[model samples]
Target: MADVTHASNAPPAHLAAGTPPILELVNIAKYFPGVIANENVSLNVFPGEIHALLGENGAGKSTLMNVVTGLYQPDAGEIIIDGYGTTFPAPDAAIAAGIGMVHQHFRLVPRFTVAENLHLGWSETPRRLSGKDIEERASALSKKFGLPITPSAVVSSLSAGEQQRVEILRVLSRGARLLILDEPTAVLSPVEVGELFSALRRFRSEGGAVVIISHKLDEIMALADRVSVLRQGRLVGTHQTCDVTPDSLVTEMIGRPVTLATSYPRQSPAPAGGEAEPLSLKQVTVRDAAGVVRLDDVSLALRPGEVLGIAGVTGNGQPELAEVLTGLKAAESGTVYLNGKAANRADPAMFAHAGVGHVPEDRLKRALMPGLSVAENMALREYDRPPIGGRFSFSMAQARKFAQMLADRAGVKLPGTQVQIRGLSGGNQQRLVLEREIRIASHVLVASYPSRGLDIGAISAMRDMLARARDAGVAVVLMSEDLDEIFALSDRIAVLYAGRLMGVMDRADADRESIGALMSGRNLSEAA
Candidate 1:
């Protein structure tokens, strides 16, 4: 790889002009049992700046941020605020020092009112304020930041974007001068994202410092003033956003030149020849344990040798839809047809037997057993069959051999198949899951967020794998939050909003604007 570490060791240019950083870390280091999460990583956040932290998964961005936020005491480092060196004993201490972090998952109590949540951990309150007083304070902060919210509304009743606003306001309410946001836009709609960026710009214009961690290069380019890249727990470099291109950043992040697979050439599915569709849903309706309708009257079909991309924001019934298709969750009404035969009540094993493979959204919880060895985990869906094992017999040797073959084919990097699956990188683990599922999927495959957290290289490879599966006469249902991925991979696009099917259309007839409008609950005509 070409060296892109031009200013790896230089301090921000403002320092030479006698401006002190709002927050700074010098020679920070952190360690796990056998992993060095960070090593000699130094960075600075100046007032009125939006600094972006860029790294592939496991590149120490989280570890470094945790040290700054007082989640973990660094093994070695000096933290400076303004000009004074300080140590934070806990998150509260960090907050007291004008530092606050908004994690990807909001930390608000669902059942509590927005006002109550804002006051829950406020130590600066000299006296117990009444409910109305708290709401009044929250309302003032909301207006000050241009973030609208109903302080009396329960947190659970708010939308994802609304909940996020509450999180940001809570930090500002606590007098946070330097704010840190982790993957803040991952689950937001485009409109919400724009709203968030506008708010961040406003915060910066008021002389507040912000650090945002994200993998979306376009977002980084558009929002960040300066970008710092981390690789293998070391600082690759920090450069003004104007000085580097997106490709250079990717090269710095993964330490290699990468050709990102943005889109594939359109290909028509093979003729059905009077055969039934591989998978189809007929007015499927699903309700959760609480009697809430998770999937409402959804109907769709998947044809062999084609990719059907299901696009939606998070929490719009994507999970319930994927579960119903794979027979993991039964629908309250309507039917799931596998090759034209109703299979609504079929269990996972029965679906698997019918050649329906699923790569679940929650990889560890639903797909792989972390404690098991790689080979063992790979054998999960085939343990009772030949080669892997028999009904009353087992074959470790065959299992390892099968696993090694699949791992090599999938380009999964691992020490050996005997190592625990949890010990591998996220990309490798996802590859293992894909290999197992694809091998078993002769008719249909359902993959949910297959490349959600992987690095660029892994994402490229994953897209290739899914495309290959589709080309090999297997029907593929791809459930994804990324609009780019959906546009790049889908032959047909389906939009879901609040558990209802907004519409389905050919990829040729779809664009980000239309899909995005549907995702926000607009009908097809309105979206058009």
Candidate 2:
């Protein structure tokens, strides 16, 4: 378990400090209608220190951040900057106080250039647009910080990490002394995360304080100077960074202790049903704009009662690969074979029929209709089927029954079947998607980041479902950035880096360290 100083039943105050804290929260309290978001929570961040704010989903971390960043006013509490206690009614107030926050979601204007993005909110007069002054300033900052950002690069052309750096530099250029990054690594590639951590280290060395709010325990163990744990709207405890291990932190974050299972295979895989082949991808090549090959020469095959895992860094054609597999995006070349028949790239309607269930990576964009009711969203996968009935019409009874069953199976905590998907939290929405995909899939299931937004319990449940699927003669193709997820769920792992299939390895042969190396493209070392 992660070594931690667990707080008592009575909430504890910030630890003793030497110099004045750069930022301090005193007895912070926030309430949203019937919900008590945070109750008398306190925290202290020192200069040159990276403070990790740890919590599970709905554990009041976002709420507390919203309060600090001036998105919401705390019902009662004191915020001290440098030394004086203050309250912010607006973001400008927080900005003026040298506090800046970057949200998990990107907010960049896609059409803007990096220079233009950097100068968007500046009060300085510039008769010329995209001027040399702006270029020089951005370039200089990039060089100084080893950021590798091009001043003239279009915002739309930058990767997730580059865009994040742009956000950070924009705030820092305005003389901000403190920064709050909420789940900054959520969208990052493994390489990008390493670079980001290096930059954070440099920033801290220069005396800027940072607070990184994340669910990634290893990251905190590597980077944080002090860690604050929050559970169910209360401060659990605060411990010095060096004193806590990843296992200890995980235990604290989840409230009760958890012994994470490694690459330990349990009962023998069940026998696959009657001689039916599962999935086959033949010569799949996805090309993008500028004639760049997103996926080149991709071919694979799997049998029933097997889990084929795809492990790759983000943006190396994983999304493109999934689109082809899920029937969302067409491949420029090649065909998909389900149950020994060619699949026409006509529509996703075929996947449900072909027994190819797909849980896409982007939940908001691809999987669920956020504006629709949970029932309606779940019914999306069921509409063309018998029970939900549709030669040309609808069966209200079947639809409602199916939706209710799925909602219950997924453990979605919404008001009812009629509750909008938007009303459900991130984890719940993910669970809904999982249930929808798993319930209807016939032969092969391709789940991409299936548990990306789920909590620990939800993640475990999803993993169990995959295990059960393997046990039931279902072919499972899983793709994820989470190493533990890949290790726990996949029987065989395929590494993809730079749109190339590196190789496949047995789950028993792949370790975290090995997979990490392969993910970075040194497959030989990883294999060795």
Candidate 3:
């Protein structure tokens, strides 16, 4: 039990402020074909406040936001903006009402510069501002928001954090007074997250209201003035953040008390040199299609029963490392050894034959067949291996049974394996990937950003699965942009920056400040 003081049924304190709420939802209800997505949900957001919408996946947070942003029309209830009762039939109408949304996946043109991206979809005025004027205006907005982004930088060439800034700036440039951000910190490094928080605070100070949807308890506690919890499409409670604890929020969100400790084995790691390394890379260098070095002289060894966590910002060579390990890309130089066999020239098929399992970052594109049935997708890696199927024929019954067994072991709750894989929630999809990869990976497992979009419960379950694999003597490479994840799961943490390995250190030696400094481009020794 938690010692949290439950929120009152009355309207939030912000409603009592001198000004009218910037945005208000009154008895909002929405429905899908066979489900109620939101039921009688009401919220009040004041100017200069950050209101956090907390919920588990499928808990109706996104649905509620979609309704507010005019992506969906609620079956019941109404919206009020700046004390005016209104309805938005489309996103442009929502924008006209001074409401804007930044979705989890950004909507930026890849080849366009920041200024050009900002100019997109705009009805050019008769004044006809030059490119220089657009860049200057965008640059001023970036500095004003404390994002410090280059207005002339190409969207494709920018880091994840910078691209996120562009998204935020786009909304602000449209004269939005109320901003809605979904999972804003999902892809950011700690430093970038700090910058984002600063920007949010500045926005609030400038009388802009924000509604942020996130599952990160620490972030909600740190940044939000008030939090509203939802479960199963119903508003559970709305409380001042100062009055709640993380445990209380988790309980309200998931209907359970969760243990926060790492589930990985607590035993001392096996000596790196004493065992035959199952996966070893030595001075591996890789180049992109454009002839730019993506990975530079990186080297590491993964011992059986150990998890080597690679931590860095996105576009810092993590993708190249994953590609090299999974045989999706050949290294330009150096050696890759899998189960003590050289895999330098190996393609994905060769790596699969060598017992390498990969759970790619983008599950839909690289790992799972979205249109395929769950059972069929689950058996993708092992269909031709044995009794489940032969070289030419696969037993549907056997495949379903195998998938069910693995799903049960992985704690994946799916309605049926015959359903399309695309219908599963983010957490369940990742669970299916974990189930298949852990079962098929005999030599080594490589999981990139495995828990990126998952809620706390799903993250815990995924960590438990990885720990089980480690306990069963499988070598694991866990690459993530989240430092907390690295600290939780890795026996040793490897830092990557500018496509090079900064340093590798035991978990005991890894500290937030030092790792953050390394991630910000400080030399490892100097950071230490």
- RMSD vs true structure, all candidates: 4.5, 4.2, 4.0
lDDT of 3: 0.84
TM-score of each: 0.81, 0.85, 0.85
- Rate residue 249 of model 1 by lDDT: 93
What tens digits encode model 2's per-residue C-alpha lDDT throughout 243-275? 678767767777667665654454664664466
Candidate 2: stretches off by over 4 Å? 1-17, 125-128, 131-133, 144-146, 263-269, 369-380, 383-407, 415-425, 451-458, 506-528
Query: Which ranking of candidates, highest lDDT first?
Result: 1, 3, 2
Candidate 1 lDDT, 1-528, residue by residue in tens = 123444533334443555668888899998876677899888788888889998877688877888999998999989999889999989989999999999865789999999889888688654878889989988888998888899999998887788999999999988899999987886676788999999999998898999998888889999988899999888878898888899999999988888766687635556565666988999999998789999999989888888999998788899899899888998899989988888878498888988999998768768999899999999999999998889799899999999999899988755678888876666778888998999889999999988866778778989999998888889899999888899999989999899999999899999889998998899988987
> How well is each residue in 101-175 modelled by candidate 3, as lDDT tens digits?
998868899999998898788654225788899898888777766768788889998877889999998888778
Candidate 1 segments whose C-alpha is farther than 4 A from its true place:
1-16, 125-133, 265-276, 286-296, 312-317, 346-355, 360-442, 497-528
Q: Extract clashing residue pairs from model 3.
A: none
Where in model 3 is the C-alpha error above 4 Å? Answer: 1-18, 33-36, 83-85, 124-147, 266-276, 289-292, 312-315, 368-409, 414-424, 502-528
